[model samples]
Target: MHKKKDNVFITGHRHPDTDSIASAIAYAHLKQELGVPAVACRLGGLNDETAYLLERFNLDKPVFLKDARASLDEIEMDQPITISLNASIKDAMDLIARNNRSLAVVDDRQRLIGMVTISNLAHIAMGDTAHTIDLLKRTPVSNIVRAIDGELVYESKTFDFNGKTSIATIAESKLKYYELKNRLVIIGDDIESQCEAIRKGAAALVTVWTEKISEEVIQLAKEFDCTIIKSTHGSMNTSRYLLFAPNVREVMTTELVYFNRNEFVDEVGRKMLETRFRAYPVVDDHDRLFGFVSRYHILNSHSKKLILVDHNEASQSVEGIETAEVLEIIDHHRIGDLSTNKPIYFRNEIIGSTASIITKMYQEHEIEIPKNIAAILLSALVSDTLNLKSPTTTPQDHIIAKKLEDISGLDRFEFAQEMYEATSNFKNKSYQEIINQDIKKFYLSNQEVMVSQVVIYHFEELDTIIDAFENEMDLFVERYNLDLLVVVFTSVVDNGSIVLASGKLENAVREAFPGEDRSFLENVVSRKNQIIPRLSTAISKYVG
Candidate 1:
């Protein structure tokens, strides 16, 4: 049976900051309180600022999601039908006919060794020749008896046989003309023919339609070290069933085509189209068989379910967001280019932080916010709005921050000081880490651009790493195929930023603010409200 996927993932955008991570966690917690199955996830690693806040609040980080594609674990597959390698071909055929599916041939330890299908058994059963009797050399005596529905009356201690089969007539004299040397002789219940066949070096005797053998013939068979079986059917049926008495190891196909359980469904579908098999085996990491996957399973499977937070643009969301089912979006940024198949619960407000919106959601739903959750939500608000000092801070943001301060019982100014100190230590971090700590991507007209930001205590700190930062920015632009790459180092204490530019459109940074120096911008604390709009305007004018 198929396992239903019910988890609704709440994720923030790539290169998450404190506000993005905190909003997802709080929103998912609120959703769970309302009886929804929700889990908070992160599209990328935590920055220094987010890590400090989570550690201070003693909360675990959200789950790191690599992509939104559905894996084979989400699909319903048929239960595995397996058979032993030592079983008879008739046993395999019986299982195949009953289940109407191919079988995975496993060894003693239940590890997959081969595969068997109806066609594999049919080819061996219908294409038998006299030379096919050679297979009986490896066939067990027990299997032969089971295949023909016969009883083993005698089992020799020193069994010896050439893999051959023949029929003996009622004429005892004509039995000598038959090649009875180490051959299984099938005949009626004639004591004379049974004794004669045994004495003529026959390996075994199948007495058809008989329940008993004479004492003299039994003694003779013991003297010849020959096994004896009494078949319930006539000679014709016994001979036909004997051809399939060999073990399945000789007929099973060993070269297998299979899939791992963790393989993505889209890639598995593409691989299935290149092959002609009806079904393929699914195995775990240990090579043990789990089940079987067919084309029907792929056709009916659904993608993962998600609820986006913090940002709404497709480029800023998780990888493979186009394939996931987006249920809702709760953000405080300008909506960009995310399109969904159906109407979603989209809540976008021009506020300071998404965490403020989430804090208000908890109050609207009448769920009491836990102390630790309240503290982290307050921290995210203070970090995003610069403790109510940024231009983007609204009256609603101040009202929500005051409400959260009462619930969390933390001084916002002291907590913000601690958060800034924790993130401002860039002396040990590499240029790549500094740039990627809080980065975003955008599509302006037809050009792809990347903007990275770092919040520091002082503007002079950039003098130490400015050369390395610019060198890495060049490589970053080439790696991501960007038309422009900009890095903004903002000092909230100074209320200004030092911006650097790289890539094909580096000159546009100078044109954005023509009166000021290219490196410095006063009273620019919010990238959402100040930096992106100026850059977008400049790039649009340059392209025109």
Candidate 2:
């Protein structure tokens, strides 16, 4: 999978329409063809019209992205260095020394259970005293043998040690003074001392610098249920190694502060500031260790790179747009409130659809426009221009549409009819879905206004649903916290629209388009060219 920072996401505005979705897909394809790692993404669900076009063209829907912020998955992290919970402390210390970082202690399933840092190991190696034997009791025999580099001469069927550890001296009288009950005793090769340690209820005996134990001593150990280990190290080294031979689980920190790989880097950084640890473990959804993320990683991380299509307004763009690096903008609308820190390649034109601009780009580059791409671009141009009927349609749009129609080998008029028919069937849709299908939010004179447009073949279809549509519009205003909400139902056959207004500035809609009823506009079909300009002017005048 490509890292998030390595891929440039080409996305349209929120609640994308056919033109928005199509322009992003085409631009991303062009960028990829030029060897840039680009991906097409959408901010919201697909409308019926856009979905129909994609299915007809055999194109997959773009990935849905929630925001444009950098996440931990994009940051460079240390590879996961892990140790098992049952592993010896020496093993953890070695791993920490090699990586110079804490190790994630995992269970049998490789799920993170705790963390062992260098501090935890140092405490065990230097400061541990009274509880050292208590810890060793929980440690396994295999760990002790591996820690001390010892051999198990006699293995008890059930090896149980009470945690007490002592060294038996060469003097037999001194051995008597040493309490060896149920304890692990480290001593020299004196056969009598070894036998006495086994008989005195000692759980295990380790003979330091001894290659072998006598058969008689082994027999006595078996009878007394004592495990005999022959260590290659001297007494001092064997005792020191034994002290740290316990499983790392005894020293690891069970309560840990970790982050999920999908977490936003800024959020993780904020959490890290509250703690003093140098690094924190990053895990997957299943709590499996993914890597370690430190403050250094967050400080060096880069924001997501983006190339906008169709719209440029911050309110209409993806969430976290303020934190993203906008590389380019290919749009047709009058510029909205989005600004980039660095100068970028911005292409904005007075055309009917952004698809027209992208179509020209393919021609300018002299690249062969793929058949499927041409088909979707033609659909977007037809939908946005309303088949050359909407006032936003330019002569250039007509020229580009013809070029796309020729390459796609599809009749634009027939395809437009089919696309409109697919969306006109509202029998299975809720009123909210129909209103939000092609909604756009605008900032007019310090007012948050929303305008939604729905196209139909005849005006009669809207007449049947006018009452329900008005009720839903009222709810839409309150739900979205809008200063005004307007729904325009346009009939392509009649070339007119019936407008309904709701919210605090409902009268502004009537003032924008004057009439006796103030609800109908003749020859007004283009929201970009006719509705937005008139509404903007009316809102400005109303505010003044």
Candidate 3:
């Protein structure tokens, strides 16, 4: 599986239409053929017409991303270097030295428990008094032998050191005065002191620099139930090194600050500023360790790269478009409010659909267009031009549609009629679904307005669902905080539309059309040319 953050996404605007989706899919396929790591994405849910076309083509729905802001997953992070909870303090120091890191930690069941730093290790080593080694009694006897490189002379049974420890360098007679019962005694090659310690109930006996153990001393230690360890080093070094033999869990820091991979960059940065830690661990949703993230990684993060296909306005685009880098834009709509910091490849035209421009690009690159691509492209052209009936349909659109028809082996008129019939069947749909199937939001005269359009073969289909439409329109207006909500029911055969207007702007809609209840427009079909501009003008005049 590829990392999603590394892949470039080609997508369309919010509430995408057939042309918006088709052009994005076709362009993404073309780029992938030319060896670019690109995938098709959508910012919003699919409309009825777009969903129908995708189902006919056997294409998976594009990846949906609600926001485009940079996340922690996009930045490079440090690898996790962890040690077990039973590891020695010296082992933690060695690992940190080999990896060139400031700290090493301990874990249990894949969850971090503590951290072992240089300062903590030193405090444990030098901070010990005569009683500090008493804590080592809780540690395993095998760990002490390994830490000091010692061998058991008489007893090799597994056990823990749970007694006081002392250096028996005093007079052999004075050793009796000091309590040695259940205590660990460290002495140098002094056979008298070794025998004295084992006879007084010492838990373990460390004989420094001794290669051979006397048979009497071994027998005495066995009788006292004491473990006898023979060290290769002298007394001072053995005692000092024994402190490091305990587990690192005894010294690690349990309190820590960390982050997750899905957190936003800005929020994490704000949290990082509250502490002085050089780096922090990153975890997944299940609290499993992922890696480490540092301040440098956050400052040098990369932005998501994108190629817009149909629209460019911020209000019509994705939620976080301002944070992404727009490498190119291929649109056929009016240039709305969009700008960039540097020069980019921008192609905007007055053509009917974006599919026409993409088809021309395929010809210019001399790449063979696939049959599925041609079929979807032609469907988009027919839908946007309304079967060559809308005023926006140009000669170029006609020629390209005919060429695509030959490649797809499908008749244009039959396919268009079938697609419109399949998408316009509202028998099982709710009134809200019908109105929001292909809705667009716009701003006119500082007021938010919504325009929804649905095409049908005839007006008779509306007689069954007209009351439901008006009822849902009232709720839609209140829910969306819209000043006006207009649903344009256009007839494919008559080439005219009946406008249903509601909300606070009812007077503005009446001003736009003042005539009989069923007065039909002569040649008004395209919403871009005949509907939106006229409605904007009437609303402006009414508001003024």
Candidate 4:
């Protein structure tokens, strides 16, 4: 009874900061309050600062999502109305008709066995006359009785008949003309003839039309060790019902083409073409039934609805953002090359943090900002704006931070310092781990460039790992075949960045800023406002 429900996933960019995470969580709350089902998601693992904030607030972390690709799990596939292996073919057919499905998944012990279709049942039903009797041989006497509305006059609890079937239509003189040895004989209400057939070594005797056999005939059948079943159905109806008495396992297609719930719809769509089956069962890794997917479901596939926060670049977004429909974008960074097929609600500003934009939206929508949520938003604002010290901090960011601070009852500068200190523990972390903590890629002027940023209160902690940073940059450039790899070390005290460059753009970096081993740019703390545009122009001029 648990049906798959589609919830819109709201997430932020890779290497998400406190602002990115808080914005996603807050916006998901807003949407749900507006009667829209939504889930907060995180594209990357939580940073130390954000993790500290979440623990302080006792909030459940967002579910980690690797990509936004529309998969079969997101689509409304047919319900898994599975049939048991012991169920009759007639029951399978009825289930299919009632559920408006082409086939029914056969399961045994809660695991997938096979599938049965209407065509499979039809092929067995309309086959040779003897095939029906052959199939019904393995059927239990109880099943045959239920199929044809019969009752067992005399038989053990585990009675079964797997012998030939013959109707006693001919005269008692012609009973020898047909083989009755070890065979089941369907006879009418001829008491003398029934006794004669039972005497001729019949394995079972089926009396149709509520026939009453005399006590002498019953005694003779017991002497011959024969089974007796009485039914109200006529001869033809009894035979047809006997055809459906066999278990569904005997007719289901065992060699199957199936899909998993996590498989992408586009990938499954291609696999569906290799076979002639119209529907394929969706199973788990342990081969348990999940649901059924059809070609028509793929044709009418629904793309995932997403709300992107913090960053907008496709490289920084989830893995399959192109496969999803972007409903809105709330960010404070310079927009990258993220384009949509349709127009969306895009709110981009030059504020210090994405949390500021989300905070303004809360007021616009008249939604109350909870105390814990306000603390997180204020923490993100202080972290991103660097306690109103960074060059990217606007007047609006300061105002929003003050307002959120009053609501959260926390001191802005002291909290900001603690937040920065919480994430600045780089002693044990490797150079690769430190630089990749907040990295974004860009495709500018036909060149693939990667820019990584790390924030700290002071620069003395990184003096030991400067060589390691350069080595990691070289390795990254070689591994990814990138045109250039840049690492910006932003310091809160200096209010500037120490830029490190490798690859083809090393000379471009020197030309942009003529300096010593590490190029120093004044008031260049923000990658969005200062570093990106400067590097974009330098790379474009150098490459062109």
Candidate 5:
């Protein structure tokens, strides 16, 4: 079943939830089943509840996403979404829908231009003013200047949305005035006042509104010898509108984050989660704008198709659900917003556990579930139904639980108890081991920083762990050669966390958190969910 990957596999929504976590793990397993390099990814930070669930199940969280668009320079971005912005927003939305989740990059003249995401257009419809100037930038100076018949004073007008046009440097003054600084001249206007204005250093001369020809005016022009011209837009329109019309290079977002034409879906997932921008512009290192990405792109992204189990509807399902190409939905919940590209083995009967539905699939295929997989599916059913306590539980859960208990050789009650205790003891480990364990890195402006977090059950552990964290951070920053560093502790049991971080990055942490009433936590209850957010918030406040 193995095949060389021609593209990346994507799954889920921007802000991932537990169902997203479980489904992604399952879907990735499905890909491995086919010998494909499939990965499940999420767009936003993990919530506290999700961390607890993942730890309880002993499942690795789905990687975080940077944007749907890929960054090709890095190996991770090699298969990034490469959609162009030359098309309509509807086209962009359609692409996002069809691709599960994809990175958006805008291009023109075979060069990466600016980024535009589905949300960017949505925000435009919502009356956001940020995109107005950027939209018109689609037409380059080459296009507009092609309409003009003037001397190429500044042959170097290749800049895109440049901000410096308002005040050209003295070195560039030659484009406007002549050497020796004599007053410029002009002619061919019926109004003497117009002629007078032209004579007063009028760098340009044009025949006004009609082609009012005059031999005398021509003679004055020959004497003064300044440039003369005629424009199709008419003298009034041209004189008033031309100069104010600046190129996109004057206002385009030059300092942009972008991806190469190729990038992988799995690799960039963790990156998208670490940063705050809902959509990072995809571009080459030369700084051209690509397409755009949004939170929805993650949900709808798909490089590898999936047959979903357990849940439907974006809210209850995993994050970046849209980013996955849904094959079939086998669930007990009511179907919500999910759309499939084609028909699949979808089974949404009124049942208890997805494990039940999956068990049926195995029976129909006559495929045996491996012992470990059976153990996991059984665990998923137990977590979702709470041992048949929830109203949604069905007889199938009880049956599967019994079968899985027999096959996996473990008592369900005993296993659940042991797992719960492990979840509670998940904290108070080595600070560096915890931080450098699963955390990722990104640069702000230009400074590199490392962020790590752990959630704990007991609040007192925060005080006990700070000194250890500080020592580890010093070594971490130096070892990673980072500019700043931070470690956070969250007590999901208390819905808050205490952060221990380098003084250099402390201000950044404060700005992200907003409220001043921060304290060192005794410990956090869910490190994955609670601590990472606070750490990221601090990073956003202080970093670029």
Candidate 6:
């Protein structure tokens, strides 16, 4: 699934939380399990709790959660799964279900306004059913979808959805009935239907066999507000499927929440915790769905497009969960956001733990589980299911955890306890470092404000983080030379974020967010879509 290995692997959501960090670690383990040199990365810094957990577990920290600029230079958006910001619920659902990886919400110039994902669409489709949704993205609907096809599910006057096929009607003996409402029209040299269609309501009048549209008919259609799709289908077949006249753009998401090509996976995970969207869109600075994010996408996500291996789910997944194509899922959890086109040998089962499943599979199939791999998997199972405390856990998980523990020469209880300590040890680190280390960057462009934010879970560390923010601010202003800055500290456990710090570009932030502390992270700290755009406007104004 990961044809692009050069693309780095990232985890973390808009404001990556505990599970998000652990999940990325688990995913990186799976990648190494498959003999790939995958990097467990973050966009923001780790909070005190997560940092303590990692340190206690003696696990290595991520490679880095660099800026979006660093990320864009890393991944490629070739086979895209585009989304429109203003896409219909039906269209968004289909595109996400189809597993499109690179998607774009573009204007006429193919310029991206923003991107979306299956999860983002799912949130939109779910509508009010879930208040903790990532809707009301700041990006515009002008981020239109390129030409796409859709069934004319419903039409105002002239179009119909007919399952990707259409036909043009040859008006041979047309009379007063020539007033076409939901059909494509093809006129003959006789031109009676053309005149009647003009007077009636022919949306499109075409000279099928010929390359031309009769001037009078064309003029008539213009008066009736009809779009002409000229085809060599002899006006006969094209008219038949006129029901499918819907522009492919009709179904694309025109208004959506998307991240830059280099959005951080950790931040995305944090956002996911706050919402129920299983996927979302990943786009360029222009906001096109370069790829999609889903529960599966994030689970195996490595950077923007490539996928690693491991337990796949929105809760246990990486960032941009909506964008990447899931190559494979080697987990022991229930079938999660991961969906593959064809049957692939994914190792999911109703087992005690993913580690147990992996161990048994390795033994039965004669596959080797590296020492480090064994350690990582065992640690995840022990930490995730609370050493088999979770109802989702099984005996197999315990057995495998024990076996892996022996192989790694680690005590199960001690290892788990230590990992807990590492995550909880929250004091010395800066909020910026804590968030940044475990986060991913989306973008920093001239057109949009350069914004970087991280999600933290330790409320106990907030007061300290706030103090550290000023120093980081001084450093950030000099280091990155940014215009506006906004950092968010979100605790998924509490289900809210404390607006820890804000920068000098205050007016812009104020204007973009008409009020202070809008909704939760899902609505506010949704990184690329909800948060960055606010800063971008301010920066645009400030820079301008």
Best by TM-score: 2
lDDT of each: 0.87, 0.88, 0.80, 0.81, 0.49, 0.50
Tens digit of per-residue lDDT, candidate 5, span 1-544: 3332233444443344333445556655655565656666655565544576556556677766554333333222223465444344444445666774534454554355544444454454454334443443443433333333332222221233321111111232322442211222122334453344335434334443435535554455455443344435544454333332333233233345544434555555566776676565555545454345444564445454444444555543444455555665666555656676667766776665555566556656556666655666666555444444444556766776788788767788776555434453435455555664334343444556555545445566555556666787778777777777766554434545666666467677666544553464432323323444555566665565
RMSD of each: 3.8, 2.2, 3.8, 2.8, 20.2, 22.9
TM-score of each: 0.84, 0.94, 0.85, 0.91, 0.35, 0.33
User: What is the per-residue lDDT of model 2 for residues 244-323, given as tens digits with 9 covering 90 to 100?
Assistant: 78998899999999999999988998999899998899899999888998999999999999999999899999999999
Model 4 pairs whose backbones collide: none
Error of 2 at 33 (Å): 1.7
What's the TM for model 6?
0.33
Better of 1 and 5 by TM-score: 1
- Poorest 10 consecutive residues of model 6 by lDDT? 139-148
RMSD of 3: 3.8
- Model 4 earns a TM-score of 0.91
Residue-level lDDT of model 3, residues 11-120, one tens digit each, is 88777788888998999988888777788888878888889889998877888866777778767778788888887776777787798664536456566666666677
Backbone clash numbers for all candidates listed = 0, 0, 1, 0, 82, 106
Q: Which ten residues in a row have the lowest lDDT in candidate 1?
A: 1-10
The true-versus-predicted C-alpha distance at residue 51 of model 4, in Å, is: 2.5
lDDT of 1 by residue, 395-466 (tens): 999998888888889888877777787788786788888989999998876789888888887777877777
Which candidate leads in lDDT?
2
Question: Which residue ranges in model 3 land beyond 4 Å of their true spot?
Answer: 1-5, 102-137, 141-158, 163-238, 406-409, 456-460, 491-495, 513-523
